[model samples]
Target: MRKMARHKDVSPEHLPYRRCVGVVLLNAENLVFVGSRTEGPEHTDSARPWQMPQGGIDDGEEPYPAALRELYEETNVRSVELLAEARDWFTYDLPPELVGHAWKGKYRGQTQKWFALRFTGTDSEIDIHHPAGGAHPPEFKAWRWERLERLPELIVPFKRAVYHRVVQEFAHLVG
Candidate 1:
């Protein structure tokens, strides 16, 4: 017989997932928005830190607005038009090493609703150095437009599943 044991004090299954919203901003060239995460645990992987803009869902917020809010908050992009929403919510778990450490120990990982939007403005409008009227620090140091299919390769492994699903769901809309 085999047995699986879990920590009683903080079992992985008992931890709540963070509710988050993800944004996939697409430009006229059919490129998707991606950014390099500027924050995480000191020893976190730097190689695959690039990701789409995402953030926690505030209390009493709807997913669509949250997605747009996160987009503006992270990338200073507000000239976008709603394109599509993912068919369903997606989730991923952080490695045990990250639990109790990431997000101030508030979540095991994130359950996210992703939104796709078309950029109706120019590249010069993007300012990762300043976001949401400068009310919050930027989450990314650099940003770029990439093919939608490349997202899984750029994101951290823990969140790759969601990115892969996003790519699959949005692939038909890509050029």
Candidate 2:
């Protein structure tokens, strides 16, 4: 049997999964939104550090509202219409190297409720450089619309599984 990794004198398995939300923001072309992460340990993947906008659910916030909040906070996108929610929450574990170093060692991984939203505004409204500013810093250095099926290929390897599931869950909605 494999042994559980320990961090801060505690086993990683003992830590709780953080509750979070992910958004698949699609434009009129049916392409999905992806952002290149501001270089960091988690963003070192060779394929591309790109990922959809995502964030933790604040205490007392519902998943849907949290999804909407996270999208706008990261992308400065507000003209979106709800399309569909994933049939189930998806999750992924941090790779061993990131086990306790990511997210300030607060979570073993994240259990995310994913949302699919259609962009109702033009591409000019998108801005990764100046996302809703306040407490949140810019998470992305650049952004683009990508084919929906290619999302899993562009995300960090540790997060590919969840992105695969999201693609499968929302594939039918794409053109």
TM-score of each: 0.92, 0.91
lDDT of 2: 0.85
For candidate 2, the TM-score is: 0.91
Estimate, for each residue in 52-163, the C-alpha lDDT of model 1 and write its tens digit: 9888899999999899889889888999999999989999997777766667666788899988899999998898998877877988898888989988988778788888
How accurate locally, in lDDT, is each candidate? 0.84, 0.85
> For model 2, where is the 10-residue window of minimal lDDT?
1-10
* TM-score for predicted model 1 compared with the true structure: 0.92
Per residue, candidate 2 scores C-alpha lDDT tens digits across 1-175 of 2334445544578878899999999988999999988965466564577899998999999999999899888888889999999989898887766666677778888999999999999888777788875446788888888999998888877888999899999999994
RMSD of 1: 4.9
Error of 1 at 22 (Å): 0.5
